[model samples]
Target: MKLIFLGPPGAGKGTIASRISKDLNIPHISTGDLFRKAIKNQTELGKKVQQIIESGDLVPDALTVALVKERLNNPDVENGYILDGFPRTIKQADSLESFSKIDNVINFVISDEQVIQRLSGRRMCKNCGEGYHIENMKPQKEGICDKCGEELIIRPDDTPEAIKNRLAVYYESTAPLIDYYKEKGLLLDIDGAQEVGKVAEATSKAISK
Candidate 1:
């Protein structure tokens, strides 16, 4: 299934995309993962992305599109892949049409208050990077990672102020894609406030249709 997952940060796009990808036996391609892999391997594109990120600027559409296209060329994506962070703009969405056709776009809907609650309660292990949610998925120890036994910390970006800023940017930049895909009859809206498993089931039903 050639699918695209659209959601704001803390909207659980990553989790839902992963579940769908695994069930469908397709690769789950995320822009963030691609950038991290490139940077870790120190590829030519990685160097440029590093510079752009260090300068506190967004990666240009051309560069982001190029990276996505490169990833789409992988053997695993031969059948199809689930895309999670590319095409945040109308231009990028148009650009993707040139190379591949998307079958569906799953849009996870959540309120700002829910996002703040979900993200603000998130804690990550400083040593192992394991994540824990205070209310939903707490760690065994009070504030320690289960696997590594290290203290967990709330990332600065997980703060309410930062989450609100991110939401503002997302609405300003990515909200239009909703209507764009809806017009194409490829948008599938799912209530993200539901439990994770329920959301996944709903996503599966949406894709089946």
Candidate 2:
């Protein structure tokens, strides 16, 4: 199942993508993770990405496209893979289409208000990086990480103001992909306001059909 998971910040696309990837036995390919791994390994591509990042400039689309192409060629993607954060633009989508055809594009739908609330309430473990929300998903102990017994902190970008800005940027940059895939007859919309399990079930059914 070559799939594209698209959504704004706090839409739970990553969680849903991880679940679907596990269920289908396909690798979950996230561009951020790929960049981090490449940089950590200090490969040739990693050096170029590092230089671009250190210069505080966005990596050029050609480099990004090349990196993704190299990743997709890995053996783990032979069956398929779940794309979490690629094709953020129509141009990138065009680049991807040149190499591979996506079977389904899951567009997660959630309101801007809900996105702000969900992100603002989220906290992460400083030591182990586990995530928890102040309301929806809480840790065993107050203000502490259940896994690593470390302090939990709200990320700076998770604040209401920052989240609102993120939502605006997402709408501006990534929302167009919804229509792009819809026109291609590969878009499947799923309500992201529901409980996690319910959303997962709906997504599974939507893609199955």
Candidate 3:
């Protein structure tokens, strides 16, 4: 199953996709991870990506498409794969269609308030980069990392204002792909506001059919 998981930031697409990847025996390919790997390996494309990222600019569609194309050519993807964060725009989606046929696009639907609440409550360990949540996954001690005994800090991007801004950007850029895939009869909407287990169950059921 060639799957694309789509959602606003904090909608838990990554979490659900990781679970589904293991259950379905497919690799979960995130574009962010691809970029990081490329940069770490110091490939030519990686050099360009590093420069673009250092300048605080979004990578061009052509460059991103090239990266996805290279990844899809790997032998492991011959069976199937879950794409987590590529094709964020119609142009990118079009580019994807040129090289691969996506079986379905799972759209995780949640409201802006829910997104803000979920993201703003998240905390990360200063030392080990472990994650915690204020309401959902609290540590043994307040504001402390259970694993490393370090202080937990809210990422700057996890601030309420930053989350709202990210949602706005998501709506502006990636939301249209919902309709794009829906018109092709390949979009599945899942209620992401539900508990994580419930949401995962719903997603599995949706894709299984």
Top model number, lDDT: 3
lDDT of 3 at 197: 93
**C-alpha RMSD by candidate, in order:** 1.3, 1.4, 0.8
Report the number of the highest-TM-score candidate. Answer: 3
Q: What are the lDDT scores of the predictions, listed in order?
A: 0.92, 0.91, 0.94
TM-score order of candidates, best first? Answer: 3, 1, 2
Q: Per-residue lDDT tens digits of candidate 1, residues 38-124?
A: 888899999999889989999999999999999998899977899998789999999999999999999999998899999999999
Give the distance in Å from residue 30's predicted Cα in candidate 3 to where it truly belongs: 0.6
Which lDDT value does model 3 have at 199? 96
Clashing pairs in 2: none
Residue-level lDDT tens digits of model 2 in 1-209? 89999999889888998899899999998889988988999989989999999999988778888899999999989889899988888889999999998999999999988888889899999899999999989998989999989999999899777887888878898899999999999999999999989989999999889
> Which 10 residues in a row give candidate 1 its minimum summed lDDT?
78-87
For 1-209, candidate 3 gives per-residue lDDT tens digits of: 99999999999999999999999988999999999999999999999999999999999999999998999999999879999987899999999998999999999999988998899999999999999999999999999999999999999999878887898889999999999999999999999999999999999999999
* C-alpha-based local distance difference test score of model 2: 0.91
Q: TM-score for every candidate vs. truth? A: 0.95, 0.94, 0.98
Q: For candidate 1, give the lDDT.
A: 0.92
